[model samples]
Target: MAKFYELQRAMRAMRQSALQRGALAILDLGSTKISCLILRFDGLDPSLASDQVGSLAGQSSFRVVGSAITQSRGIEFGEISSMQEAERAIRTVLQSAQKMANLRVDHLIACFSGGGPRSYGLNGNVKIENQIVQDEDIARVLSSCDCPDIGDGREILHAQPVNFALDHRSGLVDPRGQIGNKLDVDLHMLTVRAKTIRDLAHCVKRCDLELAGVASAAYVSGRSTLVEDEQELGAVCIDFGGGSTSYSIFLKRHMIFAGSIMLGGNHVTRDISLGLRVPISVAEKIKTKNGGLIVTGLDDRDLIEVGGETGDWEHDRRTVTRSELIGIMRPRLEEILEDIRTQLEIAGFYELKSQKFVLTGGTCQTPGLDTLASRILGQQVRIGRPLRIHRLPQAYSGSTCSALVGLALFAADPQDEWWDFELPSAGYSSRTVRKAVRWLRENW
Candidate 1:
């Protein structure tokens, strides 16, 4: 809930500052790519402040002034490996983006994947004063929650209030300004190792930029890719990147569960390199150019030239059937999806009233991936692209850009949560919520 309040606050601040001449930036720190976007807000109307993200109307309010991508460094499996190296990389990428946009941005919001994070679902109830649930009342109720100590070496990444109820009614997006004596809030809090966050913050600071906010890669991916219907219904988003695959489950347009696997496209490349006895660079090029899991009779006859670095004409010239390549790739891909399936099960994903799956991120581009994933996940599956924006180049429109694009949309229309509300004594506890779930299972 605190994270939700912080995001809401940042959104309000961005809206107010949109009238300024310079651009506001969004930086996505992923395992595969570090993307930077510089946005120029043209209108004074705050409603036009954000890039439309979730609106199904396909509105055209904001335009992307400039965007750039660079190979990420000093990060492995979503965590920072070297702070100085990462900082240098951040400066280089942002400078390039600024140059392209012809604008210098003072503020930047960053997203990250690995933090050794943990999540908890918390719910609280409060009796309203004067039988009216105003914004302050909501804030008060959230404040009343005796938030747990998320451990010492960790920082709170996102404390989002996912759902709320007024009296006996549930699924209220906004309970503010409503007349009600009883108010309830369902919150999702994500906490990461403090060292991981500090490293990211230090890197951003070195780039001479203010860290407006930071978000979990999984949460941002969910925001960028999942459709409104998928969000309203229960669904999971699996973001497969270069070195890690992040997962988040959303219901009622709010995130409920989040996690990541320490495996990605890089692993696939490694597999190809080791199995085919080729260089990593060559393996990557081959994967990007001809990688696919589903084998066909046509593929058996087709041969791909395998380039060699030794430059010996006789030894360098080699060819392999497409089917042999798929043999090496399919096992790694299946392992990734299976790991995600394990996470979903642990998160009680099957308990959802609706079960749908959306796959995105760079690695999701492998041909026939959706078919392979659906067979394992056992749910309706589709590739997701970033939504709620206009003027995006068709070449940049794909599942891979969802995180970067969603970061932009999240910068626009942020939602308020329990942390923004006031806190009072004598509220419900997380244990109580868990107990209630257990009771429901026993009774229903």
Candidate 2:
């Protein structure tokens, strides 16, 4: 636990340094596409005023100085499968973005969709030392949380104090400087496969770029797609990516749960390729051009040319009705939705105050997906796109870029995590805590 917090503190320090330098890169390492966005900050302190940092962290001021999107290679299900190929792809995108910006970036904050993320809710309380909450009190309460044994081969990705309480008064966003005898907190800790993170970090290091921070694509997608009210009340944001569909639940403007299914749009494309005996590339094109969940009488009469590169002329000229295409696509989509429904049930989503579901990401572009999701995942479903950022191109301001855009907003004004507090030297016994304190002192 101490090591995890130390790592988070180091990342936070790196992020602050990047902000002070006025330039940072946001990378979305997905299964199908790797996106890079070079943001040029105005060197303005986000803490200039509360009102300025209240919503979207003054995102309107930061501009995307450079951007690039390229096909991902040697990655599957959001994990790097081949270091050499993934490194080459990262270099390709970074070079393109740097060229556009006419400036090179050495620090990057990256988000990825895969990692076998698991969320845990923890509660902690500590008596106020001086009858008023202070930074030390906050840190004590946070440190009081008894982290569950998440087992080996996993590491903490996000440890956030979502709620605070002072004596009988609960639902406090921040209890500091308040008169209270006791401080309480509800924390959400997200853990992911250790190997997945190590590989990504190694890949970034090999590219000669410092990894300032890393985030789960699912959580960032919710940050970009879910509106303020939806996040405050309650909502689920499902990011349908190429090789995975990740969903996160938010309540009171904090993520409470996050999970991902390995199946996604790539499965649909592969289904089409295998079922129709077409090349993977052709199947992808067909899926993009003609994919839909709804079929009508007119679709039966509408024939789509499924051209093939096979030597046989007759085989190359075959056609299939839109209805047949829908038949091949619907089952796989339904299966994915059903799996998401099951996960939602496990998360107790129905009990939330507002059960709104927002669908976003590359695959959610399918026609009638909102309606289909409403039926399969229940009502109150809607398609979502990333919130508009300063000078973001129309081409990149879609659902597919939600994670990348959110990473920018997050980089500007991150949530108050455990490391944001000052821990008492005597409270922690681990040698790791001493190292963390020293690191924090040096970084700050």
Candidate 3:
């Protein structure tokens, strides 16, 4: 019951505030870039019913006012390393985005990537005194859940229920008003090191803006990347950012697992920079333009002219085979996928039996990534892009924009966050638990 009351309170507060207009910023604190987007929410337009903004599944109706990205200076592995440096980088991006949008944002929702994210699947049950589940009962059951003793210096990132069941019939999308004696819930909780969140909150607080919320990059990525069917049946979204790759699994339209690997596109570039003795800039260019896992018949003959700073002819004309370049890139890519595979396995991917997978983020755009990923993941893998939105900038409409677009969606209609809903008591659990579990086991 406590959880439900908190959820209700949050919803009430949000409804009262309405978050109608002006500017709101979403700061993506990444290892490679500190991106800030300044969005001006045009007041709801009834004439355009399609554009209404609220928490509705598969419904979006917001337009971007401005967006900007800058190189991150004080972040490593997606966590803030230096507050001062990160603050400066954030200011730069915010200033540029505000200038372009002609708006100043007082509210911000920040997304972060690191701090050793861990996922736990929790089940809570309550028996209803009566034959039906009530709001209070729902709240009581959630409160009954013995909140696990997360290690010291750790904080919960996401603790939302992924699936719910009532009585012996599972797959109950919504358990409210159901004629069931018991209630059962399958929840996915994600946690991160406490210091990571503290640093992020501290940095943003110093920026002179109110922190609306903090979200996992992987969770937001899945929001924009996974198609409706993929989300419904279950799918994993791998976000290959510059500094780290974040992963999230969704089943029954709710996020069930989330994690991140320090290895990312930056590691690949570094490997190329060192292996080929090329400048970092040139290595990045090569990775972006010619990097791939699959080497073919014509690759050996293709030669790349290395660019030089001092016009030094000695280092500028070193030609390397495409196969060699692929050789350098392939292993690192495989390692990332292998890490993801391990993460999925740990999170019970085999039990899900989901054959759909989606890859998104800036690094995922590398040539031949889809083919390579398909070979490694052994699933129907595809590169994913942000869902198309009206008035989104051309530059922010690609796979890399998944998190950004999803941030907007989250603001417009956030799912029942941790503090959103309540749980039922013993009465409800006794009536619903076994039946619901049995139903889910059979359906799944």
TM-scores across all candidates?
0.86, 0.93, 0.88
Residue 33's lDDT in candidate 1: 77
Lowest lDDT sum, 10 consecutive residues, model 3, at 53-62
TM-score order of candidates, best first? 2, 3, 1
Answer with 2 or 3, whichever has the higher TM-score. Answer: 2
Residue 169 CA error for candidate 2 (Å)? 2.8
- lDDT of every predicted structure (CA atoms): 0.80, 0.88, 0.78
Mark the 10 consecutive residues where model 1 has the least summed lDDT. Answer: 52-61
- TM-score (C-alpha) between model 1 and the true structure: 0.86
What local lDDT score does residue 43 receive in model 1, on the 0 to 100 scale? 42
- TM-score, prediction 2: 0.93
Stretches > 4 Å off in candidate 2: 44-56, 427-444
Error of 3 at 358 (Å): 0.5
Clashes of each: 12, 0, 35
Higher-lDDT candidate among 1 and 3? Answer: 1
In model 3, the Cα lDDT at residue 5 comes to 42
